[model samples]
Target: MNLLIQLTDLSIKTKQLELLQPLSFKLYQDKPVTILGQTGSGKSLLAQAIVGLLPSELSQQGQVEVFGQTHDRKSLISLWGREVIMLPQEPWRALDPLMPAYQQVSEVYQCLHDLDEESAFYRALKDLERVGLKSSALKRPGQLSGGMAQRLAVTSATAGGAKLVLADEPTKGLDVSRRDDIIQVLMNSAQGGGLLTITHDIEVARQIGGDIIVMKEGVVVEQGSAQQILNHPQHAYTQLLIAADPRHWKARDYPMIEKKPVLEAKRLAIGRNGLALSNGINFTIHSGEVVGVVGDSGCGKSTLGDTLLGLLKPIEGSVKRLSEEAKPYQWLKLFQDPPAALTCSVTLGVLLEDLVKLHQIERQRVAILMSKLNLAPELLERRSTEVSGGELQRFAILRAMLLEPVFLFADEPTSRLDPIIAKEVIELLVDLAKEQGCALLFVSHDPYLIEKRCDTVLRL
Candidate 1:
């Protein structure tokens, strides 16, 4: 039970915001430590600081000791890839999109061992299979689903031979059934070595069944075994989080309203490279209805949404616009991981403005959309890298709204949003879709969200 990671008086600060303030904790070898916090509370920042991936603009103070050795900026830089590895929140960006999935994991193995590419490739494939991914997924990140991408990231980090693995919101966007599978993979990694999982989901922490540290505003509010803290949460924040669990949605009854069909998929078959991911799928979304599609990881829920949006061409059947006279409503697709979709080294405002200009929409209308989406007008000038995941997701949706498509396809739109904000976004989308007669197709694995907002459910 020797300490593998120790943080004493750790503080991280940006120009306007303090991420973590006077944080301290110790993580032992072969044990899992879950760091809990609300969004923008520095959970991910702490992970980044530990793995030397924190942005340069964020100044740090205090000691980060790994393997009983103190790590400063220099030591941390030297320790990365050997002693520590990070499974970032956005797995799509975490891996090089250009590299094949097998190569992505193999590269890590190659960096850590003396094995040739052939051996490393096989080892990577084994790791993927262990995480429930098929051997064929080793070809590309774009070809994988949200859950598969996450599994690939976890396998890559685990195969890297790092003594301490840092996973940020590892199961954030997974469906309930898949969440357990991903958690098991992370816990297995800890059993194999050590792990520090930073997450907002209490269920995830409980599943890990390890030491737990609750954080708020960059501070450790509670620390103890998962059994003690989760069962008898001492802090108000912890209790609030537990109460806010999305799983509670099953108990609440939502208003039911009759509406006309706005979008229809008639035996649709979606594929890429002559491979069908979604075959013979049929579903319909009404003007006010939010139809949710749920399935296991890589089960083609996202592929179905992509096909509905005309982003992916169907191979056999067609997705028809049933509402012929429906108003030209805007369709906004919030990605499962926003950073991957919003990155360009450009300011958030510039991207929005460009979209507005491309659509020949008035700038004033763009400002209004941003306000409706709860984004700061000033964020226009801020670089995409400067914003949080929730903000970026909302911003992307706002940008999409400017186009005014009649059908809206939201793919895990609230994946990065806090529970409260996630609820707000869901409500807003439903209201907007109903008010404007827009057909909405929302794809998520979270059954709770579907139960709350959807008029119909489709199991992929």
Candidate 2:
């Protein structure tokens, strides 16, 4: 088998800290590999180092070779499209929101080969069609589902003839079917170039059916066959990760309290710019209840959440915050995109301070809560741009949790987390919400999560 990518004594360090430590691996054309680790374990960082996509502030040492050839930065400038393609963890950022999906893919084909616009367009369409996105060629990024976007990214990799496919948590937030589709696509594409996927999902690693590389705290701790890693783990962290999935986890029964309505909407219509996306909605959310709003993409789940948060107006109906308190209580939202919601103008310290002041909470109490979430107080000094997506998402959830809102609107709160960590976070949220008697309305696309955690599900 021909080697596709080679890393020897590779380590990456940002200005403040080391991200990856002396990691070495070789990918061959016939055998795929899966790298497993929790959030901030440097899985994504390793991929970035391999592809020369790491930020300028971060520095690396050691050798990265493609097809046994080591190319310097100046010479490696032209190596990306032809030799490597990465399906980013945040697929939303990998694409052009302004361009249609098919067009963006066509541009990839056009850039790498001598194809006319007409030919490229048809080729791109065929590529996407092969990944089961024939109907999505006309849709923009915002219009496509998370799964569809990932498939399109895969199509671009295949079209570009990349020798080594790199995927970072490709199935993080997708549903069961979507995850299967992505894994199958990668497996099929690996018939030519080997695939290396970085993930936190043991299930994803198992399905990929490849050698497993287990990483922890910036170092590789174990490497073996995927099934061997799952069935007979060598490292303690590896055992913890495999054991933490909700499938194997046995959650303690949560307190389901019977209480009056904490939030209600009547004859509601939701949309922006006077265009209604969903209407005639009526629902009552009581304290200690998880009202899971499940739906397909762009079915007004987020619109309803925004309207409830008062960020957007309920076009035609009235929303009442029927809290048990005398003073008007606040409603907090766990946004789908925390980075976008958390402004970059100020440091996170300022944001946390502002939140503390607004809620009249002590600084120490906030610090304690941050500690419980494994979020450092030092993160307070960093901006959203510096935080990883999982970290940002957890920070967003922590901020909302500390506020103790009478009603909490969560938009895919666990989307960026792995199933194991996601399960822990969900349990914590449910327990805290139950303790506070807070009304929890979770807007999510994962039907499995909604079915398992939610007390009442409202499907659209």
Candidate 3:
């Protein structure tokens, strides 16, 4: 077996503190490796370090040998498309927003592979068709659903035929079927090479079975074959992480209570750019009710939420706000991408302060809410980009809850979080919404989560 990558006592750190502890591992040809851990556990940092893409403020130590040779950051740049490819955690952000999906992948072939335009076009189509994205080939990144964009990005990234592929949370927002499809695509793409995957999804690690490394707090607690580590995890943290999967979670109980309609949609038709994806929709969400929306990728789940929030116009019919006492500020949305919703110009603490001042919220209430959400006080001092996805997401929820929203559209709120954090976040959202009589429109790909937490399920 040939070694694809080897790290000897490699570690990552910032000016103030260390992020990933010193670690050594070997990734060989024909064997895929997965790093499993919760967000903020430095899983992403390790991948970034391997690819020499860590931020300027963060520094790395020790040796990195790739494809039988040790390389510095300068030399590593030469091997990007041909030798190493990294599929980012947020695939949408990595895509070309202005280019059609087909063109994006085709360009990679034309540039990196030195293929003619005509040849690249046909090859791109075949790749897209293989990944079930042929129909959406004409769509732009901004226009496609999260899952669709993820698939497109994968196609484009692997077009160069990079042997050693680094995929970070590649299945972040995909439905179960689509997630499986991506796993298959990645496995096929890395044939005869090495695959190093960083993911919080236990399913991803399980499906990409070979070697598994479980990390928490910048240290690896367990390492072995996927079968051994996943099934018989010896570490306490690893056991807890596995048990947090929604499939293993118990159903929650809800007591009967009086209900008041908070929002209603009648004869609704929803879509983007004058196209209707779903029509003749009618649903009423009562105050304190948790409504779950489930469907395949690109089936207009997000469009429906936008229409209800008045962010997008409905082609026909109307959405009625039955809560007469609710103010405009009381209606909010928790975005799928936390960084997209937050501003990078200011620290998270500043954003919170601004919101508190604007809404006249009490300091005590803010402190209590942070505690309930398990958000560290130190997180607020950094910008949104500085915190982990799960932490930033919790902060987003904190901001939304601070408004005491009467209606909240939480779009895949827990998708980026690990199972343990995801479970906690979902439970917190449900409990808080119910306690404050806030209606929640929760969108998720996990049916188990929907079945357990939601009072009503809306199929798109």
Query: Please, what is the whole-model Cα lDDT of each candidate in the order they appear?
Result: 0.77, 0.80, 0.91
Which number leads on lDDT?
A: 3
Give TM per candidate: 0.84, 0.84, 0.92
Candidate 1 is scored at a TM of 0.84
lDDT of 3 by residue, 1-460 (tens): 8999999999998888989999999999989999999877899899988888888889899999999899878888888998899999887668989999999999999999899999999999999998888988898898788889898988899898999999999998999989999899899989989999999888899999999999998999999999999889999999999999988888878776678999999999999989898999999999899999998898899999999999999999999999998899999999987888999999999999999999899999999999998998998899988887778888999999999999999999988778987888888889989888889999999988899899999998
RMSD over all Cα atoms, model 3:
2.4
lDDT minimum window of 10 residues, candidate 1? 248-257
* Maximum-TM-score candidate: 3
Q: Compared with the true structure, what per-residue lDDT tens digits does model 1 show for residues 1-460?
A: 7889888899999899777888888888777889887887778888888878788889999998888888777778877777777888878878888788888888877878878988987888787777777555547887777777877887787776777788888887777877887787777666756889888887888888788988877778898999999899999988888776766554434455667766777878777777876677877677666678888777777777777767788888877877676444454466766777886688887777677676788978777777777888887789878877667777777766667656778888887777666766776666656665656778877877787777778887
Instruction: Please list the residue runs of candidate 3 whose C-alpha ends up more than 4 Å from where it truly belongs after superposition.
Output: 14-16, 55-59, 346-364, 375-388
Angstrom error of the Cα, residue 33, model 2: value is 0.6
Q: Is candidate 2 or candidate 3 better by TM-score?
A: 3
lDDT of 2: 0.80
Candidate 2 lDDT score at position 220? 90
